[model samples]
Target: MYSFLENSTDIHIHCCPHINKRSTDIFEVIKFAEKNKMYAIGLMDNFSNTSGYASLVKKNFPNLNLKIFGGLIMEPPAGGVSYENAKISLEYSYFENDGAKFISFPTHHTRYIAIQEKRKLDYIQACFYVPDSGPTNETTKILELIANKNVVLNTGHLSPKETLTLVKAAKSLGVKKILVPSNNFNKTTIEKLKIHNVYFEFSYFFVSKATEVPLTHIDDESHKIKGLTLKTLKDLIEAADPKNVILSSDCGVSILPKPHLGFYQFIKQVHELGFTIEEIDYMIKTNSKRLFRI
Candidate 1:
């Protein structure tokens, strides 16, 4: 209630340089992030397919002086949300069969796949199969890529098998920083993922307001809210190593009065539920930097 969201550092945010969502200008978003004491912001655009926006931030607000890490949300032949689609997007290098199986990320009608936690793999596979057959040896692709430390093989859309297999592949490959940043509803298997270097990313608004966002819905037919709930957050923190966990606002839906406000509330609630300050610090400061190589 007293704003535990203070001194927040958002590891992920898609802003003006990347997406012209127009909900708030990049300048204004930066101002808000600074006012909120957000230490680092990852500037990603689902389009443009490059980190070019990072340079724009440096050009405009050199004075603000934030780290401003840049990345793109890659899509496979299956889909593209933020221009993260590239043949090499999943592959680190052509020398080995390395890369990620982005699968079904951006939805058919909307932008990303919506799956019940139990059915995420089915949903993702359906997407990966879209416009073409899925990869033959996706596991090898994940392993070879993350093993080298040059790429972060995120589990975009796929089943639990994808998440688990990717983690194992990443581990076998030498990936120390794996991120399971699927839609919040994806039931992140903490133990299975923890065997490999990975952290589960829970979104802010999706958990708080289940019905509004496509990925966060809990309807039994299409998507089940599943892991996108308060108890899931608590359980993950309790069951897993805090250092291997991360939090994100998502802040995608247009209903927000202010961006990151709902995320602010989500993190605050997590803290109030007895998650250690040290753990929060690890997720907010250390983990993301280590994973993204920022």
Candidate 2:
């Protein structure tokens, strides 16, 4: 287990057999988490309904040795979330839904550069429903459902302007939690999301490229510790209380390094970039405890 992660427990990661991943089993993930000294791990996978062998591991392995939780990758917005739509979201098992929508929260300056420079419009569309849900009755119904439970309202793919509007609406409705994961990252989006006091998810994907890596740059050095790196992450911390930031591995891809190294390497690099250990700990631990309600 990585000693670095022991200090900053991680609560978000994708570990599923349904997908062709290098680290495709619970044993591997758990061992890595422990070996790396990562405090914990949370499971989430796109189009999956269970952690496959995770339950078996949990049943056989649940203990103080390490911590593990389940999560899901939700549908992209195709239309505004109505009550019916929100109900659908709630129906997903933690393995595939977690009531967290995979989308961008804003549309202005934040992600425009990434979109224009890297986002594949056609590929992204095929993967998710864009302009999926507009603000309408569907939106109200969805918000109301989330407001009633410990659901997480994530502005996954929306842009800056869209993020502001969507986050404000979700907050007003009293959704239990709000998240702006990787897809919602950008200067303007982070700036706007910080205003709502929502939790922001950070991952090692930004540090190293991997399959389906949504975070890529013009070159290797650009995504390095400096430059446009985790600007959104830093901004989120500066904008909100440190306890509002959360951490994730976003690992399990075939080409990326094992999650253990990914988690530690992320810290090593970010620290080299000037983030303090306490700040990092909050992003990986305290912040997620409140956001995921674990």
Candidate 3:
């Protein structure tokens, strides 16, 4: 294992039992994390809440050293941004064991992007969106729940404008930890969002060539997606303070490398790009520890 993998934390990763194909199952991911001496890993599934699965892992592996956490995504299949659903999901998490550490607003099914791309999926009966006015009553209630629980709030795949609005509202509501996916914002937006004290999550998948292909069976136009180069990722990092940045694999699709390998490669690439180990550790370990309160 590389020095960086020791005590490193990855807050974003996909696993099996997904609606789409994944390279590994949750158990495999957990085993790998433990063997690599990782600090923690968060499980993400777009169609359902993973809190229960994380609870199962914790129950079965009481002796393991690694921390395994799960979260909810506000897609149609996961109850679509309702306060009731969010509440139940948190309750299911059994937070004492590190379950439901995150509550992500919609990702691939974000209404803003779905409309922009003209995306149509059968399971997606509805898409989640926040109006220009701000979060709805239901959303406000969920935000309050998040603030109360003190879990991470990930701004998944929302349009940059919507993300900005959501972040402002979440901050005002006393939500301490907010996560924004890097692909959703540009340099200017990154600068703008960082000022609000929200962590920007940069995924290795975006820069890998494997992302040019469809990650799941339903994704047909992925080949048309433009992949971000290493230089661009470096530039994006420089756009914000290192303390506000997070590095995650965002890998698990069958088309991509396993999450751990991809994460190691990501760290290596960033280091080769002239980032000192201290700076890389700040993004990969220090900031992550702060976010997860490890």
Candidate 4:
């Protein structure tokens, strides 16, 4: 285990029992976190609620030292963005007297991106979206639930306009904890969003080319794949300011290394890029703790 990882937490990690292929299972991820003396890890699935699975793990592993949490992705498979689905997920996530810790808007199944990429999935009607006027009554109701529960809100794969609108609404609703993937928007948008105090999640997966997961439609030639190099990542962190950022592996695809190993390499590279240990820890450790309130 790397010294920098001591007491760290990764708020975004993909693991098995997923609709798509993954490199590791929940058990493998847990063992790796415990082995590295990590404080916590949040499990994310694009198509379902991982809160029930996380609850089961906690119930079965009573003596485990590390905290394991899970969240829901508001996509078609999870019942889309609705108050009912979020309520049910939270109810089902109960473990150790707490419910699900986070709730994300749609990622791959977002209406904006799905239409943009010309995806042919049958559940396109169920894809999540907010009107140009902003969140609808139902969406605002769900945001209220998220705020009342104090769960982290993740801006998943929405366009810059949609993300900004949603973030502004979530903040107004008293949703204190929010996370946005840094790669989803440009530096100017990121800097604009900084005023809301949302945590920017930086992942090494953006730089890694190996993945069995389909990031784009087969016929979408207009969409070219791009990734951030180490220097770009450094610039993004500096742009967002280290205090409001969190580092995640976003690993677990069949071809990528397991989350822990990939994360080790991520921090190592960030260190080599002239980020001080204190800065790295602030992003990977302190920000995570504050966001999740662990």
Name the regions of candidate 3 deviating beyond 4 angstroms: 94-98, 120-125, 217-226
lDDT values of the candidates?
Answer: 0.52, 0.55, 0.82, 0.81
Which prediction has the highest lDDT against the true structure? Answer: 3
**The 10-residue segment with the lowest total lDDT in model 1:** 102-111
TM-scores of the candidates are 0.70, 0.71, 0.92, 0.91
lDDT of 2 by residue, 178-244 (tens): 8776433555566667767777766776545652344322123122222234555566456554566
Best-fitting candidate, scored by TM-score: 3
* lDDT digits (tens) for residues 246-274 of candidate 3: 99998888877889988998988988988
Question: How many angstroms is residue 247 displaced in model 3 relative to the true structure, after the best TM-score fit?
Answer: 0.5
Backbone clash count, each prediction separately = 19, 32, 0, 1
Error of 1 at 153 (Å): 2.7
RMSD of each: 6.8, 6.3, 2.5, 3.0
Q: Over 4 Å off in model 4, which ranges? A: 94-97, 120-126, 211-226
Segments of candidate 1 deviating more than 4 angstroms = 1-7, 16-22, 76-126, 129-149, 182-188, 213-227
Give me the runs in candidate 2 sitting further than 4 Å from their true place: 50-56, 76-134, 182-184, 211-241
Better of 1 and 3 by lDDT: 3
